[model samples]
Target: MMKIDLQKEFNDYTQNLNKASKDQHINTAITRAVKAYRSTVAESLERFPHTPEMAAEVREIKTQAMANNSELLAQAMASVERNKGKAFYARDRQQALEIAAGIIGTGKTVVKGKSMLGEELHLREYLEEKGNEVWETDLGEFILQLKKDRPMHILSPAIHVPREQVAEIFSKFFNKDVPPEIAEEVGVVREFLREKYFSAHVGISGANVVAADTGAMVIIENEGNVRLASGAPPVHIVMVGIEKIVPTFQEAMKTAEVTWRYAQYGVPGYVNIVSGPSKTGDIEKVTTYGAHGPKEFYVIFVDNGRSEMAKDEKFSQALHCLRCGGCMYECPVFQVTAGHFGHTYLSGIGAVWTAFVSGGLEKAAPLVYTCLRCGRCMERCPMQINVPAMIGELRNRIVNGAAQGEEPLPQVAHS
Candidate 1:
């Protein structure tokens, strides 16, 4: 293996961080987003005062879920198969990509919902490379797709792209003079993706929580894109992390509720619970598959390092994250740099995720050091993940080299 240049990585990361911190678009967008998130989350908490208590209960649920992750994974896959949906377990990124490609094949148009997993696996880029046209249906994701940029926030992918820039991107893409009006911009994209939804051969999404008992994939979304993307296409494919599975449906509901609540959504516009392919029994009182919705449903449970993360006691809590994006609002570094402080994931929590799931420890070194360890993010985090503690453990491993027989640690310079 090529030796990683820790000095160069730190220098380049710092340069990017400094540059991002000074960007006017990132400043304006993050400021507005932080304010809105705080206000909305406060109101949401007040409206549903039970959320914190529910979150506490969900924490236990997550703890147990992580402990029995292997059992839950097997049960969930069996439930999916029982429900008539094909289930796949991908041990790594390559296997995940290959399975999806085998199902999708080449020369197909795919409309996909917003999925951080998709970003982690570079699913869209991979499919396109395999000769498929893929469209990101979420408005923010669509904007990023057109702008050729990655997500700046988990919930709000293009959070750094202000409306002015959006209008510019929209104008260039649509080949028209789209003004800097949010409504008009939305209308144009809505008009464009409406056709892609019905015409696309496949639709892809990520689940917020999975119920091992019923094989249900619960997706919480404010935007209606997931509904269309999953419903309109003949084939619906769900790519979710194995850590999302819970033992029971009721616990899954609790998990989903807490997730949306902390995500600043008082009540998400859509809570889709998909178990299997759409079916009907009308004509002769006989059951039939493929009504007006998707005829085929496939679920790929991606493990790509998540299993390893769950096994380690110090890092297992990181897998409990609901991806609410609330911690980013409270994170001082994230407030200033947005997603520049991250790799595929963002903020303090993201650093832990990058270390385990998306990118390994070496890739996560810069982000690990970026954390202020003020514990402000914990105050806002629904999971109350001890990110500072995790960061400290990562730093020790980086400095002293990884545990016996693990990947050799890079030579990182002390500040």
Candidate 2:
């Protein structure tokens, strides 16, 4: 893995925010994208009719679900096992990677669906180093994988890259002139990934929500890539944060609904729910696994500081995030810097997430301070996470030179 000084990078990006905001290419991309997103989301919300009452209900469900996290995890694991799937818990990033790699083994071909949790662990790099050929099947993740760049946005990985730049990237990648048109670019990707989907030995994905009652993991996507990636291979591995577990399937669907609703879609194009390894009861009363889709299904519940964060009420709220990209559209700072303003996660919610999940107060300090404290993010959030309030809390903790669960710094004697 590459070494990155989050503090230094944050400082540099903060210093150059003005220049970035003024850059014609960046400004054009962001302005157009944000405008389109806001417009579409407005229409989606209007059409879907998400009432404040519904939002409040979802909030209560998530709060209760999160509060009963341990019980839900145990139930989810039991449920997965009963469905003829293997379930594992990863306490941290290292363990997560180790478990995933052990399942994947080495010298195997793997195709991946876009997964932020996978990104959080740099899973591709780990697999590659272990001698496996892994490809990111999602178009956006594919572009970034080719460019060797981090995701600029959570949902839309290469949102910062203009179409022309993509044309350039694709041209070099394909060893031919690829047109700048979106359709042609998408065609090139589709054609290239078609073979990978069928040939890969393993498929990796992240779940939007895991139902504790049924052990059904829900994946919502506009692109069919997730379905293909998770289905084509004989072995399927799903890694999801523990916070994504909801108490029941109904609540899980509701979570998925609200997530894409605020993510600028009235309904996702595909909603894939996998309870376990593919089974066939067509064999005259005998149940058989591996009939189609993935023969073996594995779910890795990644704790990775979530259990710690869950203990703190304010920080626990960060886990309530639905991973909707809506808040970024409303964030003035993000509109300018794109993903540069964040490290792993993006925007204000990302600040709180980074503080807990990524590193600590020092790492998140730059982002916490960079937040404009504009209430737009809160207004737009599906989870209604009070980002500014959380940021203020982070700032207070940092200013007092205190770490989480520690006493504040002592005051120095003034001369």
Candidate 3:
């Protein structure tokens, strides 16, 4: 199990975030996330001139939900258990991190929301190896969690460091001389995540869509830290991935208006819509639960192989992807391999979601032949989603390819 070096593992995750790829802060964050996702896909195709006829009606509603994925995932798990939401269907990734660390039990304090399915289910090192003080609150995942480092971009996680090395890792982890300035390292990570977004007690997130006719769980961020990690923690998880569900809410608001114009090239003024937890009864308005927010709102629907790529209609159009990091910065091999464009949902549709949620194409088959099939990721794919002809059609359906036997990727011995 060795061969990983996709550019010396992103130059040792940018030298362990002491941050020095001064190729001008990852080319100024891949030129500001590709000029704000190409001015939000040219202002969402000029304020929706039927974005290529609603991306051919979301590719025929993902061609009849991947042509019947177990009766559309049992009608999206009975519409998230008829809206009370407690679905838990994990088929892998350590049983969805032991059912989200057993519904966040022991001594609380989680607060997440930057989720590449909670960092491919590492889930904050398994809830800090069961001790719990999670906290990622997404300012590029709080500067790659103050330099422990891993997310090099699933929508700008410390896009290979360079706000003067994030003002020198916030002047040596907040020992205080910080002024190299990128809006003062975003006001010292917004004055240290506004006291962990009001004293966290468990509020994870990751659901860019899950509307099965309004079980309603969608979040298309511009950073209100996923509406304060699913609204100020009263226990609000959402891990999501049953191909992020869509049988409605107008096809999950056209997959969150083409996933925020394919990740901020525009149109994001907070499109949140989280239907559950945030109760109020104010003077006989009655029917209450937790007047402020998040009073236990779980929704862990994972299916780790995405039901074998939803019964394979050519890897089920990679489950109609909307994780929209814009086919990883328009993959010229992910603009020359940033975060090695293969794993945690990066380029070539994150090598078809790491060959069906972490296992396929074997060490992701030479990162899916470094995709220069160059359809230019289907001309900034809103839903044009070709992904270099599905990584040459899942590298001919992985018959000893995308590497598990090819070897030669090991490098990093820089002591």
Best by lDDT: 1
- Candidate 3 lDDT over 1-415, as tens digits, reads 4554456643554353223223555656677767666776777778777766766787777667667656666777777676666777889989989988988867678878887887887789888878888878888777778788788678777777777777888899889899887887788888887788788888888888877766788887776887887888787888888877778888888867767666754677687888666767786888676668887687888888888777654557767777677767766655544765556766677777787787565656666765667677777665665666667766664542333333333212210
Could you give candidate 2's per-residue lDDT for residues 1-415 as a string of tens digits? 3344566866676676667677777778888989989888888778877645567788998899989999999999999999999999999999999999999999999999999898888899999999999999889999999998889789988887888999999999999999999999999999999999899999999999999999999999988999999999999999999999999999888888888888876778999999999889996979999988999999999999899989986568778898988899889889988887787888898888888888667778888889988768888887788787778778888666555666353312110
Each prediction's TM-score versus the true structure: 0.96, 0.94, 0.34
Q: Residue pairs in steric clash, candidate 3?
A: 36-265, 37-265, 39-265, 40-265, 40-266, 365-402, 365-403
TM-score of 2: 0.94
Give the local distance difference test score of model 2: 0.87
Mark the 10 consecutive residues where model 3 has the least summed lDDT. 406-415
Q: Which stretches of candidate 3 lie over 4 Å from their true place?
A: 1-74, 77-112, 115-136, 141-152, 168-187, 190-192, 195-204, 207-228, 231-287, 295-312, 320-336, 339-345, 351-389, 394-415
Provide the global lDDT of candidate 1 against the true structure. 0.93
Show where candidate 1 strays beyond 4 Å: 1-3, 404-415
Better structure of 1 and 3 per lDDT? 1
Cα error, candidate 2, residue 137 (Å): 1.2
